[model samples]
Target: MEVVVVTLAYTLTGRDTEIVSQLRTVSDTLQTAPGLTHLRSYRGRQKGGAYALFLCTWDSENSWRKAQEQYSPHKLLQEAHKRQELLVIDPLQWVMHYVWGYTRPLAAPTLAAIHLMSAPPEQEVLLQNGWRRTLQHHVQEPALAYAFLAHSTTPTTDEAHEGPVTVLFCFFSWSSQMERDLFYSEKQIRTMHAFSEQGSSVQILALEPL
Candidate 1:
């Protein structure tokens, strides 16, 4: 699957009307979009800093590109941007971060989390390999629906001017949020935490399907 992670940092705090309306419009169109297997929306909770994430998976990169040019949501979003009703801190930010297809097909009942990692260039491979190994145990868990990793092709804002930085994206899905929380709280997940600590920094986004 080709996953496109579109993150928008809004200027306002808490449910801004225009942003919510725009997102609702996009989510509605995404439900019936061709080639789109899944669409998860996330609203950031930071008090002073507010943002949202739209994680979308498609059959291929070509399909995604086609949607950008022809899809209704894309057209709506473009119009919103033009009117300054929907402002994103990084409008050009888009990442292709799913390297492999999902372990299970996308479904409405599943819940997922996205992890954004950055490490020194030299430690990139090590971080990727270690994290992959750490997730092996969870892959077979009955509650886990799917999981995959992706590396960023461009430098993230935080890494600009720093030494070569690699962005690592990983997504883990479970049948439900309750099941995911239960499984994630286990002591064994600490091992994955340790592996991630090897990187310079990491940010995790718990995603909800719209």
Candidate 2:
């Protein structure tokens, strides 16, 4: 399975509540789309705005293309796009990230790490250290694919729930569920578990490409 993760960042021009409500509607529509596997909407905590994250899974890139073609004429998507303009300050550009299934490409692994933090303002150093250690040293699985960290700026708008201070986004690819299982159970993952205890809270999700 392969998937495309699309992320959009929007700056709200008015009240956070109104902006979030529209985002929820868009999410609802996306959830019903044929090729969409997962759709998550986030409101910026430090920077007052909205960030929309969606994962569209496919058997191949060709499958994704077919799905896109089908969605282009979708009335719900069109309506949502219009509503988005009211809430966003700038033009929306779709940012695309690719995920390759490990089963097909045995030589490559798909891995992703996302860290959400809500803690003491002074813990910035600790947070950075945790990210570096986990992404660089801990997840040593040779099949490891790609990794990245993302954070919002100041203003910190409340969309659905108040946003976290920072969010770390990482991606990795693997051949099979068994391999992922092994990697997660490894000592490095244990070390990551211990490191994460320092945060006020955290959320982890396992996702498959569409």
- In order, what lDDT does every prediction score? 0.64, 0.46
lDDT of 1 by residue, 8-104 (tens): 3453454477767776776777667788887766655454565556666677777877776655344545666676656544343455655543565
Return the TM-score for candidate 1, rounded to 2 decimals: 0.72
Q: What tens digits encode model 2's per-residue C-alpha lDDT throughout 137-204?
A: 64444435434443322323223235434333344445566666765778766676566656545545
The worst-scoring run of ten residues by lDDT in candidate 1 lies at 6-15
TM-score against native, each model: 0.72, 0.44
Q: How many residue pairs clash in each candidate?
A: 0, 21
In terms of TM-score, which candidate is strongest?
Answer: 1
How does residue 181 of candidate 1 score in lDDT?
Answer: 79
